[model samples]
Target: MAMRASMHLVKSRTLLACAKEESEYRVRHPENSSPNARVLVLGGTGRVGGSTAIALSNLRPDLRIIVAGRNREKGASMVATLGGNSQFAEVDIENVKSLEAALKDVDLVVHAAGPFQQAERCTVLEAAIQTKTAYVDVCDDTTYSWRAKSFKDRAVAANIPAITTGGIYPGVSNVMAAELVRASRSESNGEPERLRFYYYTAGTGGAGPTILATSFLLLGEDVAAYNKGEMIKLKPYSGMLNIDFGKGIGKRDVYLLNLPEVRSVHEVLGIPTVSARFGTAPFFWNWGMEAMTSLLPAEFLRDRSKVQELVQLFDPVVRAVDRIAGERVSMRVDLECSDGRNAVGIFSHRRLSVCVGNATAAFALAVLEGSTQPGVWFPEEPEGIAIEAREVLLKRAAQGTINFVMNRPPWMVESDPKELGLGIYV
Candidate 1:
C-alpha cells in the first residue's frame, strides 16, 4: 500500500511538470492559441490529404477546415468525414486563380498534393506567398523542396512562414535527425560522422496512387548521398541494407533513393556522411521495384504523364496487395560519431495513413502556433523553424506510434540487439 501511494505521487509530479512545460510553451507562442483559425488542405480528396484533414479536425475540433481539390465529390466526402467545422472547396492546384481564391480566407494551407518529383513550378506556394498565407507541404522530392527553399526571401518579404518536406518520413524524420545531432553535440558524445536513414513501409503504405506515382518518378533520378563532406550520385535503389525497426517490425531490407531529407540534414545538421533509404513489404514488391528500374527507360520513368498512366495501371493491384500487406511504417535513424559512439532514433506505427496525417498536422499546428519565422524553412533548420517546438511536434507526430524512441543507443532500439559480454550491448 505504501509503495503504491509513492508511485502514484511520482506519477502526479511528472504530470505536473509536463503541464508546467506546456504552459510555458503556450505563453511563448500565443498565435497557437487562436480560437478561430481557418485552414485549407489542398488535395484533400487524396489519401494523404484526406488523412491530414481528419487528423487536423481530430486535434483541434474548434478550427474550421476547408478541403480543397479539383474533385467536388471527393472533396465533399472528405469534408463530411471532418464534421460540422469543415467544408469543401473546389480548387485546382494548377489554376492560379483557383489557388489564390482558396488561400484568401485560410489562415494556413497544407499542400498535400504531391508526386512533387519533376514538378517545374511551385504554383501553390506562389499562391500562398501572393495571398500572404502561411504554408506547409508534404513534399518528398529533393528538387521541389530546394525550389521551395529558394523562396525564403520572398516568403520573408511576404511575412508568411512556410515549411517544405513536412510529411512523415521527410518531415518528422528530419526533426528526429536534428534532435539526435543536437543531443550528440550538447552531450560531447563525439564529432558526428555518419547519419543513415532507413525506412520500411507495407504495400502502398495505404497512401494510394499518389505514392505509387512518386515511387515511379523517383526511379528515374540518381541517388545523391554525402560522404565525408563530398557529394556522390549513385543509381537509385541499388544499395540495399538490412535494418531492424524494433518490435512490431522486425528486420527489413531498405534501398537507396533520392529522398530530400538526406541533403537537408547533411546541410542543416552539418553531418559529414548522410544517406536515406526506403523499402516496402510483400517482398515481391521490392523485387518488382528493382525490376522496374532495370526494365523501364529513365526518360519514361521521369515523365509525369507517363508515370500517372503507370499509376493508373497499377493502382488496383497495389490496393489489393495493400489489404494483405497492411499499412505499417517504420523509420530508423542511425548516427555514428568519430569516437565510435552511436545514437539512434526509431519511429514505428501500425498505419502509415494515420501516422502520416498526424505528422503533417503536427507541422501545421507548429506553423499556426508561431513556431516558424517568416521564411521557407526545412524541418531541420534550428533558428526559428522546428527547434523551439520540436518536443511538442514530436509528441503530436508520435501519437499512434507503436514504437518511438530517441537519443538511445542502437542496441536499445534494435530488434535483435547483440550482447557483447558482461552488461554491455552493441
Candidate 2:
C-alpha cells in the first residue's frame, strides 16, 4: 500500500537522523554505557507506547526491551518488530500485584499507557515506588500529573526516580519553553513575563482511542491559565488565537486547552503568565469539539465509561481523517519578556508517530543516563533532566524533524506581523 510505503520511508529516515547522533549521544550520556539496562514499556501494544519501544530499541540496542500490555498477542507482535533485543510482558497497569512483579526486573518503566484524563489514581506510579524502579510517563492530564507530583516525597523516600508528562507536548515542549526562557534571559537580559504553548496536529496525529478518550475527558474540566502572575479559570475551547507555527506548518487558529504544561511551566520556569492551546486540521473538527464541549454535560463527559463509547464512535472517523492528513504535527513555544521582546521555539514533523516515539525515547534515555535524581519530577527539573542535558535531549527528540529551531525573535519565524517605521515594529 502507498500508506505503508510512506510510513517505511519516514521511519527509515528517522532512524538515520537518530543514528547520526548516536555516537555523540553515547559520549554525553555515559550512564547508558553498560549492557545491563532494562526497559519495560507499558501500553506497548498501542500507538505512542509501541513507537516509543521501537525508538528506544533503536537508540540503545544494548538495553533489553520489554513490550508490555494487557494483550498477549499484541505485546508479542510489538516485541517481534523490536527484533532480538526485545521480549513481551502481559501486565495490567491497574493491577498493582502484576505491575509490581513486572517491575521486579525492569530497570526502568516507561508508562505510555495513557490518555491519562479521567483517571482516578496514579496506580502505576505507586507500584513503581513499591518496586523502587526508575520511571517516566507520557501523562498529559493536568490533574493526573499533579497527582503524580504529589508522590515526590514518597519517590525520594524509596530512592526511586520518576518523571511525569514526559511525552511530546508537555514533555519536549516543556523543555523548549525552559530553553527559550533561558536563552532570552542570557541573550538580552530579558525577564520572562509570559509563556505560551501552541500545538497543531493534523487529525489526531495518528493517535488512537486512548487519545480520543483523553480529549473527550478534558472537555469537562475547567481550563487553567496564569494571567499576569495570577491564576484564572476559563471555559475550555474559549480563548482563540491565530498562531503562526513557522514554515512547513504555517498559521492556524488555536484555542485554550487545559494542558498540564501550562501550570507546570508557570510554576517550574517562574514565568508570570502561561497557557497552552491546541488545534487540529480540516477546521471543522475544531467546531465539533466546541460543540461537544458546549452541548455535553460536564458530568456526563467526566464519566470514563461514557467517554469510551464516544471514543468508539469517533475513532473510525478520526482514523480516516488521519490517513488523509498524513500525521503532521507541530509545536511552537513563545516567550514574552518584561523588556518588550519575544522569542519562540518551533518544532514540526511530518509524522507524529515518529516524533512522539523519539520525544518519549529522549526522556527515557535521560532517566537511564542518571540525569534525574531519586524523586518525582517533571521533565524540565534541573535535578531531573537538567538544562545542560536539554541540548542532547532535543537533538535526539528532533531526529527526522522537518523543521526545528529555537530562541529566535518573532520576526524571524512569523509569516506576517505589523511592521512600524524604521524597523521599530511592535
Candidate 3:
C-alpha cells in the first residue's frame, strides 16, 4: 500500500512539474499566444474536422473559426454549434481556387479531410502555400505525409508552417515518442535502441466511414518498419502482439500496420528499430481485416473509390457495432534502451471521436502560436514542434484523456505490473 502511494505521489509530482514548466514557459513567451486567430477547417462537415472545430472553439473561444466544406447545410449546422464567432464557408478541396479563396484571410487552416491514403496530391497544402496560410493536417498516410514533406522548401519559400500526420495516433503518438526519445538521451537512460507504437480502438472510434475507409486503405499497403537501422517491408496486419493499455483499457491484440509514425520517428528521432501496430475491437474486425488483405486484391484496396464503395456497404453494420463496442481509444508507446531501461507513454480516452479532434487542435494551436517553423515537418521534428512547447502540446492534446502518462517506467504504466522483490517492480 505504501509503495503504491509513493508511486502515485511520484506520478502526481511529475505531472505537476510539467504543468508548472509549461505555465512558466507560456508566461515568458507571451508572443506565442494568439488570442484572435482566424482558423479555417477543411472537411468541416466530416467527423474529424467537425470535432476539431468544436474542440478549437472550446479551447479558444475568442478565435474566429470558419467551417469550410462542400455541404452548406452541414457546414452551417456545424457553425451553429460553434456559436457566433464561427461561420460556414463554401469551399471544395478539389478546386484550388476555392481552397485559395477560403484560406486567403484565415490565420491558419486545418486539413482534416482524409482517408489521406492513396491521395496523389496535397491540394489543400498547395493552396495554403500559394496563399501563404499556416497549415496542419490530420494525415495518417505514409506516402501522403512524405509527399507533404517534399513541399518543405516551397512552404519555407511561402513563409508558411505546415505539419502532416498531425492527428491523434500519428499526431499525439508521434509527439509522445519524441518525448520518450528526448528524455532517454538527456537522462542517459542507456543508448536508445527500440521504439514501438501500439494502438487499440473500439469499433470505428466514432469517426464514421472515413476511419473505416482509412483502415481498408491501409491493408492495401505494405508495412514499413525499421530494424537495427535497416528498413524492412512486411505484410500489413501480419505481426500481432498483446499489449496492456493500463487503466480503462486492458490487454488487446494489435497488429503491424503501415503507420506514418514508424518511418517519421525512425528517421527524425534516429531510433534504430521502430514499428507501429494498431488494432480495433470486437475481435472479428481484426479477422475481417486480415481476411480482406488475403481475399481482396491490393489494387482494389488501394483504390479510394473502391474503398469508399466498400465503406458505404459496411457503414451501417460498422455503425451498429460501434455503438455496442463504444468509442474507447488507447495508445501505448514503448522505448527500450541498450542498458535494459524501458520507458513508456500512454494516452487513453473514452471517445476517440472527441480525442482526435482535441489532439489535432493541439497541433493546430502550436502552429498558430508560432512554435513551428515555416516549413513542412513531421510531429517528431524539432522544427515542427519546438522542444520547449512539447509539454504544453501533450497536455492540451490529452485534455480529456482518462489515462495519460509520459516518460514513465514500463512497469508503472502497465496494467499488470510485475513485482520483483522488496517493493521493486518490472
Candidate 4:
C-alpha cells in the first residue's frame, strides 16, 4: 500500500515545458556538422543499415556516405538511392581484414548491421578502437551491449567516440527514460522509483530478416528485470502489460523482454526498478512466439545456424504479414516517483523503418558534431552523447516522428484512460 501510495501521480502538462526547452536549445545553438566527414555504414544493404544511410545522407547533405556490405547489387542500389553524396563498398562485418580495409580513411563508422543476438565478440567495436575512428552501432542484444560497454577504457585510451545500442527502441527509449528521470527530480522533489519501457511494433518492424532472427533468438533467453532495488528474473513474454501508445498507434499488450536498455538504464540512471516489455500487432504473433518457447528447446533456438533456418522459413510469411501491418511502431516510457508523482515520455511513428533510420542518423550526427567524449558509452550517458547535445539529438531524431511527448501524464496522450471522479484517473 505504501509503495502504491508513493507511486501516485500528480498531473501536470510538463510535456510542453520539455518541448519548449528543446526548441529553445535548437534555436540558440545551430548544428555544427563535422567538416569533411565521411561515414562508412556497415551492412548498408539491409533495412536498418540502409535506413541509417539514407538518414545520414538526408541530415548531412555535404557529408559523404559509403554503403558497405558484401552484396554489390544491393549496396549499389542503396548508394544510388542515397543520391550522389553516397558510394558503395563491398565489405563484410564478420571479416576482420575486410573491416580493416573499409575503416581506412573513414572519419566515422556506423555499424547498423545487426540483431546482434548471439554475437561472439565486439569485433567491430575493437576494430573501431584500433583504427581510432568515431563509432556507433545499433546493437540491441543484452550481452553484446555490455561487451561493448566493457571497451570503455580501451576506447578512452584510443580517444575514439563510441556509442552502442543507438537504435530506436533501445536508443531513443533509453534517452526518453533518462530525460523523464531528470525532469522529475529537477521539477519536483520526486525521486524516481520505477521506470517501465513499453514498445510496440507491427510485423517485423519493416526491419526484415535480421530482426526476425533477433526475435526468435530472444525467446530463448530469460528476462532480467529490477524491482525495489532488487534483481528479479522473469521468463520472456511473461508479466504482460497493456499500455496506451497514444493515437496512430493505440493500446498494446507488451511482455517483458531481455532488452539491453533495461539493465543499462537501471545502472546508469540509478533507478530502483527498470524493466522493458515489447509487443507486436495482430496479437497472434505474440501467441506464436510464446508457443515457440514452450515447443522448442532453448538450446535449439540458441544456435545461430538453426535460428537462421527459422528466419528463412518464416521470412516469406512475415513479409506477407508486414504488407498488412505496415510496420508502425510506438514506444512509451513511464517514470513513477517516490513523492506520488509520475511522468511519461512517448514516441510514435507511422513506420518503424524510417523512424529507426532517423534515430540512428541522429546519433551519427551527434558523434560528428563532437557531442561525445573519447570513450564507449550508452546513448543516455553525458559522456556518450554530451549533456548539451541531448536536445539536438532528440530534435533531429524526432523529425519524422508523428507524436513525441515527454514528461506528461498518461491522460494527456492516451485518448482514453481509467478516469475517476474529481479529476482523478488511473
Candidate 5:
C-alpha cells in the first residue's frame, strides 16, 4: 500500500534528521572504472541499489552501468544522475522473459530491488541461474537469504557466481566477521575457534522500517549459535548486552538475537560460535526493541493506515530527535582460539549508504575483475576470496576509515569487561 502523504513528509524530515547526525564523508579514492567490465543493477532506482550504483560509478569509471527497473522515468532519472556510461531499461522483475532479456550478455547482476518477501516468487533469481550470470543482492530479508543459499549447489554446478546479503548489516557484517576469523586463525598459527559478532546502528534512519520488518520475521524463531561445538538456540532478546560504540555512537544496550550472520558465520566459516546483535543511537536502538516487541504480534503492523499513522507521528518527532542527537553504525567481531588466545576487530561507519554501498560495490568490482568465482559464496573468510575485496571496500569508504581493534576497545584505549557486556542487554 502507498504510504500516506503525511507519512512521506514525516519520513523525509526523519531522513533529513539522520543526515544531520551523519559523520563527515572521508575522501574517496578515484574510480578505477575499467572499460571491459559492464554491470547491470536491477532496482537501481531504489535506495541501496541507487547508492550502490553511484558508488560503483564513482569508484570504477571503466564500469558501464545498465540500470533496469519497472519505471523508465525513474530509471532514466537515476541514470542521468549517474552521468556518463550509464543507461536504463524498463523490465518487470516478476517476468522471467523480461529478466532473461535484461540478463543477456551482462557481466554481473546486482539485485538491489526488494522487500523480497513479495519478489521471491518471481523470476529474478531463476533468470540469473538460467543466464549463467553472476548475481549479488542487497537483500535484508532472512528467509530470502536462506532460500538464496539453496542456490549454492546449483550455481556451482552451472559455474554461475552469486552473492546475497550485500547490504550493511548482513553484507559487511558477514565479511567483517569472516575477516576476523581469517586474521585470528592466521595469528593463532592456523587454528580457528569460537566467534562473536556485534552489529550496531546509530545514524541509520532510512532503514528503520526495514530493520523492524526483519526483526518481526525472526521473532520467536530459534536463533542458532554454536555451543561447545554444537549448534544451539539463543532466544531473541534473551541475552542483554551493553556495547561501547566509541565516541561517535557512545555506549548502548543490545540484545541477543538470532540473526542471519549466525547461519553463515558458523556454517560457512566453520566457527564454533557466532552471534549477531543490532546497535543504534541510544534512543532509536531502545525504541526499536520496544516498538517491535509491541507491534509485531498484530496484523496492525502490516496495516497501511496504522503504519502511516505511526510514520506520520514518528517522522516529525524523529527530526526533532535528530537535532538533539546524532547517528552512527558500528560492528565488532571477536575470535577465540581453543588455545585461549583471542583477536578482536571492529568496523564503524557513519553514513548508512557508504557502509553498505562500498561493500556491495567492492564485491561487484571483484566479480568484474575476476577476483571471485562464479559459484555462490558467502564471505565466510577473507582468505578464500579475492585478497583485494576488503581493500577495495575499505578504500571506497576511505572518507570513514573502518576502525580495527584487537585486545583494546575502539571507544576506549583500555578494556572494561563489564562495560562491554553490561549495557547492551537490558
Candidate 6:
C-alpha cells in the first residue's frame, strides 16, 4: 500500500510539473518573432531591460536593440521610446522554441527576466548555448548565478560568453574585489590575499518581481560560503553588519547573504578567503527582511505563492521610491592580509539598474574594443580587467547617472610601495 502511495505521489507531481511548464511556455512565447543582428534585450519591456536599452542606445546609436518580451505592444512601445534605431519583438525565456527563435541572428543576449527562484528544470543559459549568442543576464540571484556554472563548459565549447549576476552586488562588487586583490598581488611579489565585499542597496527603491525572485532563489539554495576550506550552509539574514555607505548615504545596516560570487571569485583567483554581505536602505527595511526570514523557515522560503504576494506588494512601492528618493546602490570592498594590512574601495550610484547596466556596458564595450584578454573570464579575472572596469565605471559615474567611487582606509590612504594604490586600469 505504501509503495502504491509513493508511486501515485510521483505521478501526481510529474503531471503538475508538466502543467506548470506548459503554462510558462505559453506565456514566454506568443507568435510573431524576429531577432536583430546587433543586440537583444530579453526582458526589454521591464525596468532594468528598458534602462539597459536606453544606456546602450545612448552609447552607440548604430547598434540596434531588439526589445523582446511576451507583450508585443509593451516591447514596441519601449522600442519606440528609444527612437528609430531600436525595434521590438516577441520572445519568452520559459519557452525554449521561442527563445531559440528570439535569439536567432543576435550578436548578444541580455536576459533581464525574473523570479528565477522557482526555476528548477529550465535555464536561460541552456537557451544561450542553443542559440549560440554571447549571453549576459542581470540576475541578482546569487545561487542561480552559481549553479549556472553547469553550462560554463558548454558555453566555452560554443565559443560564446555566458555571464550572470551582471547587476550591483555580484557584478560591480565582484569586479571591485577582483581589481583590489589583483593589484595587491601585482605590487606584492604576485601573491593575492583575502578580500571582503559589502553591498548596501539603500533607499528601498526599484524592487521588482525579478529582485524578489532572486531572493527566493537564494533562499531555496540556502546560500553557502567557503570558510576555512569547508562549505557552510548560511541561513538567510544571518550575517548582519553596519557598513558605512559614505557621505550622503550614511551608515546603513546590512545582512549577510549567500552571494555565490564571493566563493566563485575565490575559486577564480585562488584567494583563500572571500565573503560578501548585503543590506537594504533604512534600518526598518533591513530589520523587516531579517524579521521575515526569522519567522519563515526554509519550507516557507520554498513557497512560490508567498514569494509572488511579496512581489506584488513591494514592486510598486519600490519603483515609486526609485523614482522619487533618488535611492542609490552602494558597494564597499575591502582586501586584507594576515599582518593587519587592508585596502577599501567604494562605488555608489543613484540607480541600481543604471549601475549594473553601465557595468555590463563597460565590460561589453571593453570586449568590443578588444580591451580584455581573450578566454573565459569573470569581470574581475585576468588580473587587469577589474582595474580597467573600475576606471570605466568611475569615469562614467563622473558624467552622472552611474556613480562608481573607490576609497582606501585612512591608515592605508597614503601612497606606499607596501600598499596598492587606486589600481586604476586604462
Task: Give residue 247's error in model 5 in angstroms.
Answer: 4.6
Which residue segments of model 5 deviate by more than 4 Å? 1-34, 117-122, 189-191, 207-212, 215-222, 282-285, 298-327, 381-384, 387-389, 397-399, 402-426
Q: Which model is ahead, 3 or 4, in terms of lDDT?
A: 3
| Model 5 root-mean-square deviation | 10.9
How far off is residue 104 in model 6, in Å?
Answer: 1.1
Question: Each candidate's TM vs. the true structure?
Answer: 0.90, 0.90, 0.90, 0.90, 0.78, 0.79
In candidate 2 the C-alpha lDDT for residue 243 amounts to 80
For candidate 2, the per-residue lDDT at 71 reads 88
User: How accurate locally, in lDDT, is each candidate?
Assistant: 0.84, 0.82, 0.85, 0.81, 0.61, 0.61
Output the number of the lDDT-best candidate. Answer: 3
Residue 165 of model 2, lDDT score: 95
Q: Per-residue lDDT for 266-370 in model 6, tens only? A: 787676756667777656666767777777676767777877776688777766665655557777787765555567877777767566566665544433322
Which digits, one per residue and each the tens of the lDDT, describe model 5 over residues 1-426? 242332222112221122311211111222222244568898787667777888888777656788888888888899999888899988788778889998876767898876554234525766888877777877765566778777777876666667777666667667667666666667666566666767676534444444344444445355566654577655555465676655455456666666667777788778765666665554554667556655565455434445556555566555566445444567766666777666666667666655566667866765544444545666554322454456555455444644644444233522223322432211
Clashing residue pairs, backbone N/CA/C < 3 A, model 2: none
Ranked by lDDT from best down, the candidates are: 3, 1, 2, 4, 5, 6
lDDT of 1 by residue, 155-227 (tens): 8788787899999989999999999988888886579988989899999899998999999999999999887
lDDT of 2 at 53: 93
Q: In order, what is each prediction's RMSD in angstroms?
A: 9.2, 8.3, 9.8, 10.6, 10.9, 13.3
Global Cα lDDT for candidate 3 = 0.85
Please give, for residues 305-344, the per-residue lDDT of candidate 2 as tens digits: 9999998888888988878877889999888898888988
Error of 2 at 103 (Å): 0.2
